[model samples]
Target: MSAATSPPVSPSAVTSAGRLAWLDALRGIGALAVVAEHMLPWFVPSLRPYWFSLGVYGILVFFLVSGYIIPASLERHGDVRAFWISRFFRLYPLYLVVIAVVLALSWWVPVREAVVRDGSAVAAHATMLLDVVGIGGVADTMWTLSYEMVFYLVVTALYLTRGHERSGTWAIVFAVAAVLVGLVASGAVFGGGWPAYVSCAVFVLGLTGVLVGRLRTFSACALGVMAVACLLLSSRVPWLGTAVLAVMFAGTAIYRWERGTGPLWPVAVTGALVVIAPVWAIESGWWWVQADVWLTTILLAAATFAGGMALRGRRLPRILVWFGLISYSLYLVHHPLLRYFVRVSGDLRGEPLAYQLVMTAAALVVIIAVSAVTYRFVEKPMQDLGRRISRRCRGGPQGGGEVRVPGESTGDDRVLRHEERQVPHRVSDDVDQGESVG
Candidate 1:
C-alpha cells in the first residue's frame, strides 16, 4: 500500500505513463511481499521463513513511499481541502468496499475475535484508527491503516502550519520519543471502547473543521495533538506506533534531501533509533522485533527505497508499475479473498508441496485479476471524481489547467503541463498510497 501523490514529471522525462514508475515498482514489490507473507502460512507452510518478516518489510516500504510523497502532494496543491479530498477518495472507496465484503462474508468467515473483544468495530473502523484504539480490523491487514491515518492527520496539521518542510527534525523527534516511551510506557493507558468513541468524535470534528475552513488551523493542530496522544497512550504498542511515525517522517526527510531542501543526517539518525526502539520494549515480545531480525528488515526496506530513488530517472519494468497501479486493491482485497478460498477449498497446509504451490499460484492469479478489476471500476473513477470536485472547490474549471504556486519547482510546472496533455484534470495518479500488511 502507498499514501502519496505521484511525484511531478517533467515534459522531457522519458517515462511512458507521465508518472513516477519507480514508486509504482516499489509499491508493486511491497504488495507482492505482503501477499506472499499471508498466503504462504496457509498454503505452503514450509516455505514460510522466520528469519525476517516479509509483512513488516512490505509495510515499511509502504510507509517510506507514503512519507516521501504525501507531503509533496499537499505542498504541490497548496490546499488542504483538495489534499484531503484526494486522500479520502483514494483511500476510502476501496476501504469501504473491503469492509462491506467482510461483513457480508462474516457468516462464512466470521469476524476476528479481537474485533468482538474490542467491541467498537464500527467506531474504530470508521476512523481507521482501529489498532491504536484497541480494536481489531475486520481484515487483519487493516491494522496498518491506523498508523496511516495518524500520519495523515499529523502531516495535514504540519502542512497547515507551513512546518511541513521540517521533516528531518520531526523524524528525529519521533525517533527519540519512541525510545523514551519504550523505556517508560508498557501498554495503552486508555483502553477499551470509550477512547474509540472519543477519538472518533475528535476525528469527525477536526476533519469537519479542516474541510469547512472554520478555525482550520486550530482544528488541524488539535487533530495533530490528538493523533500523537493516541499513538502514545492508546496504541497496542506505544513504542511501535511512535517508531512507525519516525519511519514515515524519515521518508519525508529523504524526499526533502532529494529536492535539495533538507539534511540527510536525520534520516540516518531516525533509522538508527527506530531499529533499536523495540529491542528493549516491554510490549515487544514478537520474534521479528528481536534485534537481529528487526535490524535486517529495517535495513532491507531502507535499501529498497534507496534503490528506487536511484532508478527514478530510468524506465522501470511495466509489469511492476502495473502491479503498483493495482497495489492498493491487491493489498485490501487479497486477505479476504484468501479467507474465502480457505472456506471453499479448506486449508492446504496438509497437502503435497507441489499441490500447495500450484494452489498458491492460482490464488495469486485470482487476487491480481480481481484487484485489477477493482482498480479499474472502483479506484480510478473515484479518483477522477475527486479531481473534478477538488477543481470545482478551488474555483477552477473542471477541465484542463496547470496550478502554479509561488515556490513550486520549474520541473514540476513542466510536469504539470505534460500531465494536462496526457491526463487532463488529474491532480495525481498515485492512488494506492497506503501500507501493505499481513
Candidate 2:
C-alpha cells in the first residue's frame, strides 16, 4: 500500500478470511444475474423485465477486480515472460474450452436469432476483443473482457519495464485524447464510435499506475473525482460503457493509493457513488439528481473497496471461493448457454412455458458442471502449472500475493500454497520446456 507492496493473494486481505470466497460470491452473484437476464422471456409477463441487467454492473465489478488483481500477478513474477505465461495458462485454455463448447451447442440447441447474431459478432471475444470491429461484438455480457486482457497485457509490460509510474499518466492522457478526437471527428463519441476506443483504452491506460511502489493521495482524489464526473454525465455519455471503462481505470488508481490501510472511509464513500451512477439516472427525478448520483457512485466504489479491505481477514466458505475462481469463464459462456437451452426447450413444446422452466433448471446445472469442470480440470491446474513454470524460468518466488517485478515483497498478499513450497515439483524440469511451448 505504501511502498511496492506485494500482490494481494488471499481471496481478500484478511488471513482468517477466505479471500477467494468473497470474489467467488461476487462472481456467482454476477453469473446469476446473467442467467436471469437471459431467462427473461421464460418468466411470467409480470416477472420478465430483465431483472438482472444489473449483471452488467457485475461485469464492471469483474473489471475493477481485474484491475486490482492482474497487476498483482504480474508484479509477483518480476518478468514479462513469466507474467504472460501465467496469463496464457490462466485464461486462454479455459476460454477456448468454453467457447468451443458454446460453438458446439449451436447445433443441438435452438438459440435465438438476436442471441446468435450477437454471439457471432464476438468470434474474437475469447481473444478478449469485445470492442473490435465485429467478427462478433460484446453480445453475451462479455464485452468487459476486452478491457481485462488489454489491462493484463499493458500492465504487465509497464510493470516489467518499471515505467508504470511514469507511463501511466501519459497513457491516460493519450487514451482520453483518442476518445475526444473520435468524438470531434464524428461529432459523437458513443454508439460504438471513438469513445469506444477510449472505453477500450481504460484497461490499457490503467497500467500506468499499476506498477506503483506506493499509493498516492492526490491520484486517489483525482480518480475519485473523474469517476464521479463520468457517472454524473452517463446519460449523455453515449452507451454508458465509457463510464464503465472509466471506473475500471479509476478502480486501479484507488487501489494504488489505498495502500492496504484497508479502504479509507472517504475513498470508500466516493467509490460507491461511481459504481452506481447509472442507477441514479434511471431513478432520479431530474438531470441534476443524476449529478448527485455521480457523487453517490464515487462514494460507493471507494467504500466497497475499503470494505473489501476490511473484510480481508474474515473467514468465508470454501464453496464461495471456488465459485469466484471460475467466474470469468462462467460470465463469458452463460449467455449463449442460456440461449441454447431456450432454443432446445422451445422445440420440446410439451408446454412452451413448462419446457422453459425445465430447461432453465437444466441450464443452471450445465453451467455449474461446466464451471466446475473448468476450474478443477483446467483453470486451477493450469494456473498451478503455469506458476510453477514461471517460477522455474524466472527463478523467483512464484506464488506470492502479488508478482514482484523487482523480485521482492511489499506484503500485499501471501504466497499461494504451492508458491510457498521451495521449488514446486512441476517447475524444476519444466520451466524451460514450458517456456518453449508457450
For all candidates, the clash counts are 5, 56
Candidate 1: worst-modelled 10 consecutive residues by lDDT: 424-433
Across 1-438, the per-residue lDDT of candidate 1 in tens digits comes to 111344543222224443466677888889999999999998999999788889999999989988887776666656777777767887899999999988897888897787854447788999999888878888888888899889999988887777788999999999999998888888798887888989999999999888888778899999999899899999988889999999999988987787677799999999999987884552447888877888899999999998887777666787887887788899999999998888888889999999998999899999999998998999889987877777676564421122344456545545554544542122235421222221
* Candidate 1 colliding pairs: 1-434, 2-433, 2-434, 3-433, 3-434
Q: For each candidate, what is the lDDT?
A: 0.79, 0.45
For model 2, residues 1-438, the per-residue Cα lDDT tens digits are 443465444332223334333444444555555556555545323354332233443454565555555454444444555555566676677667766776666577533343235433343443454443222332355445554554444444445446554322423432353344324332222233333333334423332233232332233233333333222232133224344444454555544554442333423433443434344344534332254444443344344445555654566555645555566556666666666665655543335666556666777789778766766777667877877776665654423224354433545323443333433232211212111101
Q: Which 10 consecutive residues of model 2 have the lowest summed lDDT?
A: 429-438
Model 2 lDDT vs. the true structure?
Answer: 0.45
TM-scores for the candidates: 0.90, 0.62
